[model samples]
Every structure is written in structure tokens, then in C-alpha cells.
Target chain A: MDHSGISVLFEGTNFERLLGGLWVTVKIAAVALIVGLILGIILGVLRTFKNRPLRVLLRLYLEFFRIVPTVVLLFLFYYILPRQLNFNLPGDQLATLVFALWVAAEMSDIVRGALISVPQHQRESGKAIGLNRYQLYRYVLIPQAISLEIPATINLATRVIKTTSLLMLISVMDVINIGQQIIEANNHTHPTGVFWVYGLIFLFYFLIDYPLSWWAKRLEKKRLERANG
Target chain B: MKKKSFTRIIAAVSVFAALLLVLTGCGNAKKSSSQSNNPSSVQQIKKNGTIRIAVFGDLPPYGWVNKDGKRVGYDVTLAHQVAKDLGVKVKFVQVNANNRVDALNSNKVDLVLANFTVTPERKQVIDFAKPYMKVSVGVVSPKNKAITKASQLKGKNLIVTKGTTAENYFTSKQPNVNLLKFDSKTQQFNALKNGRGVALADDNSYLYAWSKDNPSYTVGIKSIGPKSYISPAVKKGNKSLLNWTNKEINKLTKQRFFVKDYNTQLKPYFGKEVKPSDIVLPVK
Candidate 1:
């Protein structure tokens, strides 16, 4: 409500900083979604392998990431991974990498489910034509599996965007980080400006993730239409 | 049917590849953001006639939101003065402890006033102005089971805000103390109040402030370990700004402006327990 302190947010480099941070959030989400999809497909396919060891290992990987909290996983990246694994990455890059790995693990289960949902008759028909295993997957099974996974994939992508805000803990200057920066800078003079500022931040995130949600839903409807037609 | 499916597969892969390219381009664009040196180049600031400042908004008493939803605290007080002394219209920017250094280095802020502590490790990365507040490390405990000595903290759960001097000191010296560190003091205080830990360790001023609002909690001890000073921080190699700030501190110290500052900003939380002289360091 205090227009004076909160108004600074709209003017000069402060607003630019917020946009910069939003860009970081977008970058992290995009990178993580892509990496997650690729890794998830590999893991998902491995889960179907006849070898008991590989399937079991893939299942364990899927379970571990699913059970652990994303923030704790992020901590593992920020603190333990570098010291133990010697992966000395910058904070923002580390956040993107870790979130991608987490998303991939979660997404693997979605991929596995979608793959299983593809009818056995389809694979049988491909085999009747003497199609190679790789060609069968590339031509017949994977595309249908992905189309089924689209809705879940969009859900997972939004989750990555929401979770990227947690990277503020490790000092990654994302959108929430900019909000914190603005609040701190103005607190002394504005004293009551944080509510408006943080309130506006909620709006900023809503503006981004909500549209993605709508687009995903619209795409889901189109897929349903094509399936019916 | 087989040809149609193969075409679909190729299309999907190509679309996926295009998405990857666009995202990679986005990442590169962010990483290579234009290096705007306006704030860092203080020479330009002198010409512009304004200095930008960044402080924490959610940190109470030091920097936090008040009831009407505005940021207010001790750091904000000095920040306004520093800008005034610079003869530039002050532009306050919000930042937290985590983003303080980056905000400064990125030229988003001219100075950092976010309850920043003067630590040797941090001094290496950023130049610090003269210390304005005396910040001694202390602990808060439930009145029922108070801890009066630093040695009492050994082997007990000590909740501290992560990335603070409290965590640093305890981790370095009191290794046996089980640290349940949180990112915010609100959480640390909650842990202490909820009986999740025996005590919470942080700056004396914060403990004193907490004790005032909640009489049930008491600060069992005063200061422990090597004393720490709180000061505004600026980016390294800003000698012009640093020297100007040092002179301003000297003027404020001579004018008893610091006493006024302490009385206005800190006295409410401190009450009559801590003498003014105890807080006011000898001008050196």
C-alpha cells in the first residue's frame, strides 16, 4: 500500500533485475525439462529390460528421487555433491543441473507408465513385420508413448519452474532472489513495502506458470480430439 | 501406416531438437547479459547524482516486514544516512543476506546495508565500510532451561540461521554442538520456541529483540567468542566510495549521531540492559 517504496520496483534497474531473474527461472526450467525428458526416456526404457539387475536398479533410482524432498536434494547438490563428487559448479548452474536430475527421475516413472500403456498388440504387429528392436521403438512405440506423456510432462515442467525459486538459498539470483533483494534494499526507508513487493512477485510467477498450464491443457484437448477423430 | 508412424517419429525428434536449441540460446543470453557497470563505476554515479542501496526486507528489527507490509529495521536507518552523506538521491534496493554480494558485484546496488557482518573471509571478496554496530554472538533459550555459558552449548542442539556469524563461530569452535541451521531467523526462533532445540545462537541484538517481544524467552548470556562488528559492505576496488564512507562515519561518530542512531533504532529491543557505552565502540 505504501506507494513510495513499492513504486521503485517499477522504475530503473530494479525492474530490470526482476526480469533478469525471471529469465534465469525460465532458463533453468527449459534446461531441466529437456535433460529430464532425455534421461527419463532412457531410465523408463531400461525399466522394461528383461535383465532383473537393470530393472531393479532403475526402480531404485526412481524411488530414491521420488521420496526425497526437492529442497534436500538441492542441498545435496549445493553442499555434498561438489565436495564428495568434485563437481565444482557455479550455484545457478548447479541448481539447474540438480533440478534437471530430480525432474528426470520423477519424469522417468511417467515415461515408464506411458510406455507400458502403449498396447502390446502394436509391438506385436511391428514384430510380425520383422522390424528390428531399435526400429520398432523409434518408429512405433516411442512416439505414442511421448504423446501419452505430454500432460504429465507439462505438469513436471511447471514443477521445475516452481522449485527453481528454492535456488535462492544457494544464492542463485533468480526471480525470488530479486524479490528478496528488493525487500532488503527498501526495508529501511519503505518499512511497509515488502507486502506489496512480495505480493507482486506472486503475481509475476503466476503470470508465467499459469499460461504454461493453459497451453498444456489446450494441447491435451487437441490430442484428445485427434484421438477421437 | 508404417510410413506415417516413421514420419511422426522424425517430426517429434526434430521438434525436440528445436526446443533444445531455443533453450540453449536462452541460457546463453542470460549468462552473457550486458555488463552494465553504472553502479560499479562509481565515477558514473557521481555524474548521475544518485546512489542505489540494497538491504534485506524480511529480516525483522535488522530488516523485515512490519504489520502494514513494509520493510523496516536497523540497517535501513544507516542506509538512508549513507545515501544522504553521498549527496545523491537515495535509491533503496531490496536484497537478502544470500544475494548481497551478487547484487553489489552485478552493479544492481551501490552499497549493501543488509545487516552485513565484517568477516575476514567476506572481506577478501568485498571491501567493508567502517563498522556501525557492535554485534556480539549470543544464544537464546527457554527461560525454564537457560544456558549461561558458551561451554554449556557443547553436545546440545543449537539452532542457528544458516550463513551467519553464529554458524561460522560454532562450526569452527564448537564442533560437538549439533547445529539445526535454518535459512531464516524466524525458523531458528521457531525451532527454539517449539523445543526442537535447547537454544538458538545468533547476534546479541536479535536475541535481545526477541526477548523483549516474548518475555517468556530470556537471553541467558551476553556475548561469547570473538566479537563481530556489523557494517555496510561495498564491492571491492571502490576506494573513492570507501574513503567517503569512512569520513562520513567519522563525522557521525563525532556528532553523537551514532548514539541517536542507537537510541532510535536499537534501544527499544535492548531496553535498559545494555549500556549505550557497551554498544558504542571507541572511535579508532
Candidate 2:
């Protein structure tokens, strides 16, 4: 079998192409994660407020994102969103927007659950110290809630990174798009290039995601150790 | 407690409603405007340095990868020339048949060079340049026992790519035939190869390409329906780009570039079955 094609992947142009795609993946995931975290925290906090209206609204928002598939959401944003909304956003930006929506819903549920899991004693102590509800949250609640939130946030981060691969479906040309380009480029040389190309993509995705997941697991373990101590 | 909770819920609903309104505004600005422009706007072409041409990478003969690992085909060659004539570099993007019109309207690609046929229904979404390549639908089956006529497929399973003319024709013309739908040629071809379907229907040029290596399979029938010509597709209202492309194709046509293109890229499979004049039609 001719292995010369493999050399170009490591050498000049193909290497740059690969790196460019990886960068898009990173940028998409990072934006999604940051945006998702902020939105998640807000929703999570609202969900915990003992108000019936907030609870129902949060429930509806969470269910919409939770039940809808990310790929469908990506298409809805990329294709239908522009036509229906009368605004034209580029594909990459739209991918980020849709992914943020998905990540926010998932992350919010995690944040809500984790924040509630923090001891009721913490809230009681804040109230006893003449802390206003806002001050109690600012000084007493958020810091501890964050510790509980980190593992779930990290989990959401890993998911966003993986899910960004779906951006390829909407024409964002991330790592999977590069893989398809490589496969299409090599089809004349190899009849079954898609198999190898997609296999390599799986490897590329795993290389990025596996470490994040492992790191999250390690962080969780350390937090658990600290908590027990 | 209930009153405070009710106010917070209303706040949340209002925020979501505002977001929906913003999204709808964006969508309206980008939809349907692809339809009103006609082909005279050379100035607009000059402003855009890159011409986006959509091709179906999985579809062979028209646009596919060859043995050298480069995308080369009749449509790719034609697109390059069209871009060169417009004084812009060509950027080929893959789009499936169903999404080709949306890609044009959404500004994803400047024009679709995929094996797109001119159809009355599709005209509502995108504009068509003059015909640069003529096409006919055909069925492919095992060479040894290929189905030779429409009736031969009467009781047999026929695989067709979804949203293609093949699917459109077969469903209307041969309703009794067991029609299998796939989104890509890759799957349909595989299904045909594996005996899941007795034959596959698609553009004749593509069916010819698939039948080439699998001497086991042959394009058993030809010219199964009305003759249709392939054209470059553009956004609906961009008359300038459309006109420019038509003029360029006219020049290419006179030089027999499309004929040469067919021979170089398509002839290996078709072997002189295609006529040169049939490549580009009178500017209609």
C-alpha cells in the first residue's frame, strides 16, 4: 500500500490544515463553555429560588434543550434560524450559538443540583450574620457552590468539546470537516479513504476529549478527598 | 411567596420571548432574497474575490476524487473555468442534493456545481445558468443479470438517493417498484453491490462510473426518462453572476472545453457514448 499520503499529513500544508481545524474546535468549545457556564449559573440559581414561576420556566427551558438533539439544533440555527429570524450569521458563529444553548441547559441543571446540594446550614449561618440574601449568596454561598459545581462544569466542558464536532454538519469545517476533505482528496489514491479518514478523526477527537475527561475525574477525586478531610 | 414566584416566572418567559424575536429577525434577513436577482451584475462578482461552488464530493463523474487524491471531474473543471472567467478563485464546497438550493440562498456557496438538474419545482429556490452538461437518468444492475427495461424493475428493489430526480421519477413513474431511499450515493451504491437492491437509479454518468470497476455491475439501461441538462446554480436574484456564468459557459462551449472535459474525466466510463454538442445547450 502506498504510504506517501501519510507523510504530507505530518509535513507542510496538511499539517497546517490539521492544526487550523483543531483550533476551530478549541475556539468553538471554549466559547460554548464560557457562555454555557454563565447561563447555567443564572438558570441554576433561578431554579433553586422557591418561586413557582421561576421553577416552571426553568423546567421548560431545561426540557427543550435536553430533549432536542444537538445536530438538529445546529441545523435549526444554521439553516432555519437565518431564514426565520431575518438575520444572517456565519456558520461558525451560529455553531457556537447553538452549542451554547445546548451546553447552557445541561450545565444549568448540573449547577442547580450541585448548588442545592450544598448544606442548608451555610445559608442559615449567612442569614444569622445579618447578611442580606444577596450578600449571603455573594460571601457565603457561591464559593462553596463553585467547589461543588467544578466537576459538573468540567463534565459540561468535555461534552461541549465533543459536541462541537457536530459543527461539521452545519458547514463550520472543524476537525471532522478536515477529515472529510482529506478523505475526498485521497479518494482517487484509496478507494476506501473514508474508513481511514473517519478513523483518524475519531482518534483526533479522542486525543482532545480523553485528557479533559481524565483531568475532570482527577479533579473530582481531589475534591472528594478534601471534602472527606 | 406565590406572588413573588409568579413575577420571576414572567420575567424568565419575557427573556425567552425576546430571544425568539431576535432569532426570527435574523432569519428573515437571510431567507428568500436569493430569488429576485438576474444575471447582469458583474460589479457584484468583482466585489467578491472568491466564488463558492457546491459539489457533491461523494458523487463521481460529475464531481469526485480520483486515484491521485485530488478532486477532479466534469463539474469541477467547468466550475474552475467559470470562476477564472469571473476573475476570482474557485472554492469547492460539498453539499448534498437536497441542501444545494439552501446553500445557495444562505450564501454558503456562490453557486452550486453539484450534479444539479434543472427542474420546475427547484426553480422556486435558486436560479439556473444555461445548461452546461446534458444528463439522463439510468439504472445500474449486475452486468451478468442486469435489468434491461423499466418492467424488469417492476417487482425489484431499486435504491435511489433521497431528494434526487431519480427518486422523483421512479416514485411517479414506477410506483409498484420497491424504492429504497438513501441520503448518499455511497450507501445506495453499497446496497446495490450487496444485493439488497437489484438496481440503483441516478444520473447516467454517475451510474456509469459505479459500473466501471464492478464489471460485475453494468448500466443495464440508458435514457429511461425525459432528457434533462445540468446547469450551474446561483442565488435567485443575482442576475449578474448568472449572466456572467452563462457567457463564460458559452465561450467554453465554442472551444469544446466541455467535450474535452467529458472525454478526459467522463469518457473512461462512457467511452464516446456522449455527443459533444450535447454538453452545452443553446443559451436558453
TM-score of 2: 0.76
Best by TM-score: 2
> What docking class should model 2 receive?
acceptable
List residue ranges in candidate 1 displaced over 4 A.
A1-8, B1-133, B136-280
Give per-residue CA lDDT, model 1, range A77-181, as digits (tens): 665554343334556787877877788788879888988889999989999998866778878888988889888888888878888888876657788876775
> Which has the greatest DockQ?
2
lDDT of 1 at B167: 93
lDDT of each: 0.75, 0.75
Error of 2 at A158 (Å): 2.2
Which portions of model 2 miss their true places by more than 4 Å? A1-19, A46-60, A185-189, B1-43, B48-50, B57-61, B64-72, B88-93, B139-202, B215-222, B237-244, B263-284
lDDT of 2 by residue, A131-203 (tens): 7655666688788888887877777787788888777676676877666666665554465656665666678
- TM-score, model 1, chain B versus true chain B: 0.71
